[model samples]
Target: MPNVPRKPRKQVAALPVMVDPKGQVRVLLITSRETQRFIIPKGWPMKGRKDHHAAAIEAQQEAGIIGRVHKQPVGGCNYWKRRSDHFDYCRVKVFMLEFRYQLPDWRERGQRRGAWLPVDDAADLVDDPGLIDIIRTLPKRLATKHKRLALKPATMS
Candidate 1:
């Protein structure tokens, strides 16, 4: 008898925090048809594509935003859920990327709309505090990086 191979685990990436020029920290939240709950924009990674490419595509399709992904990965998380008919816990890695543009015509996407809110307000909007924690940390991290760069000595020509 031949043995059947198990299906691969599912992985998803989410962008939990974004920043504006004003230095305000915000999160891009999406409401899906299957789930009424507001979740950070995310989707399964596409094969043969870079992580950031998947992230960018997910943002455009799910949130109707066209943007560039940051090079750094803020952090990742793991979670579990049932797969097919079998009950299983799957590990999903979360990523944080800032949406580089505003959605002037988000209605065109026809999937869902998104909004940017203060990190604190965003925390209140989402059900999971863990996600909120991720959003809240972004501002401090970006600010610290900016400060360090500003303090660096100027390079000689």
Candidate 2:
């Protein structure tokens, strides 16, 4: 068979964020199992899940935390996924997860290290350029969303 270039695989990611008492946005990042690089919780799309739900599941498994995940995508990033015999390109859709609480113990806790850092610091720590851009622009995106929400008329129900 002749070689043909494969299309980028689709993936989902959760950008877990919390606001400090000082109102600073902090992002939670986990170390990738193999590379130990800083990355948000992300994985392949589940067989029977909405993409955002799958991203939430990934966050629970990889980062031991859960939050309110936005239904719409905030942004996306492209990266090369290393496979056993080859590298595959992946496109990741990212959703913002409003931080709730963290579990003391969770799966993959031992396999990876998780940390909460200021947005700018986390943006600088991640290696993927696209992901970095997403992290950097997250605050502006959130502000835009908030403004839109404020503009909506209130409903009495």
Kindly report which residue stretches of model 1 are placed more than 4 angstroms away from their true locations once superposed.
1-10, 16-22, 80-88, 102-108, 147-157
The RMSD (Cα, Å) of candidate 2 is 7.4
Q: lDDT scores for all predictions?
A: 0.58, 0.82
lDDT of 2 by residue, 1-157 (tens): 2233476789999998877666667788899999898999999999989999999999989887767898998889988887778877789999888877777778887899878888899999999998899889877877876722111111111
- Specify the highest-TM-score model's number: 2
Clashes of each: 1, 0
Error of 2 at 135 (Å): 0.8
For each candidate in turn, the TM-score is: 0.69, 0.88
Top candidate (lDDT): 2
Off by over 4 Å in 2: 1-6, 147-157
Prediction 1 TM-score vs. true: 0.69
